[model samples]
Target: MLLEPKSLDNIIVGLLVDNFFKWYVAPKDLWFLDRKKQADAYIKKFKEIGLKNIGNKIEEVDERKGIEVLDENSFIEFIRRINKYAVSTNELRESLKLNLLTTSKQDTFYSFLPSLYVNVDKRELYSLYPEPASYEDFVPKNWSGVYEDFLPKIDWEEKYWYDKNGIDLLNLENNRGKK
Candidate 1:
């Protein structure tokens, strides 16, 4: 999350990046393979935080070095500080401003890897140890409330692929029995 920062009055600062990952990437089930092994793998992945600069260039950050994890009390304070930034200051009805963050309360958007926004979605997460991907989850998270195998984004089936004889490949798949 944060490499190092000074104390904020009595509260410690810096807990965005790691906590965000915990909320998402940290698998809810701990009883697969082995507990210690799975935890180690998860923590190691969290250490490699993704960063994208203003230029949209992405990079990997090892958050483990010289970093401090947030305690329960400090974490609550951190969330409060974050929420203060999320309050929408720009009234969309009055102005034509389209920047979503113009009215957001997040003080800063940590450009987690593969992301350009302060809030990183699951699609932006890169796995160091990737599990075998099932065809079912290819449609990306933004497609709906859940990951689905069938993506409306895919339009190839609608287009025709012709063979040497000009027979459509798609029709051939269905016309297998009819000579």
Candidate 2:
């Protein structure tokens, strides 16, 4: 899974769902203090973190693995699920967008490119299925080429504001205040 800290809700949901699989579906003893307790903990954390308000049910995600995070095949399925809950309420969609800062003037940091936002985030592998150990499992050939061509399309200066001038401008006000 590629995780963007900017998408806290998505990350939390993904982690809880993953933990649920490790605790119950796989029947791993060392994964938690107890399976039931672990499930409850996951639920509580979800609620505490405000995911429940967004209609993200921590209990509902199927534990069966082999789910691709973002690919052509999985994109359709992911959109269907998102529409089921997201389309019903306008407020929820806005909340989600706001939470992700998808419309921030700063640039799109979180993209729902298949599932939810691709931010050049680092990838980690956690699967319930006996698949390849990491994201290497789903990566297509020409991966480097994909990055070279596709990544450049996303203007990093506009999106992440990492340029030296941008950094200096961002800190200018604070630096002046300190002086």
Best by lDDT: 2
lDDT agreement of model 2 with the native: 0.28
Q: Clash pairs of candidate 1?
A: 50-113, 85-105, 85-106, 86-104, 86-105, 86-106, 87-105, 88-103, 109-118
True-vs-predicted CA distance for residue 139, candidate 2, Å: 3.6
Worst 10 residues of 1 by lDDT: 109-118
Worst window of 10 by summed lDDT in candidate 2? 21-30
Please give, for residues 23-109, the per-residue lDDT of candidate 2 as tens digits: 011111111212333445557768897776444232334421333233334434543443323221223223334534545533233
lDDT of 1 by residue, 62-143 (tens): 2212212223333344344344222111121112122223533221111111111111232222221122321122222332
Per-residue lDDT, model 1, residue 164, is: 35
Candidate 2 TM-score to native: 0.23
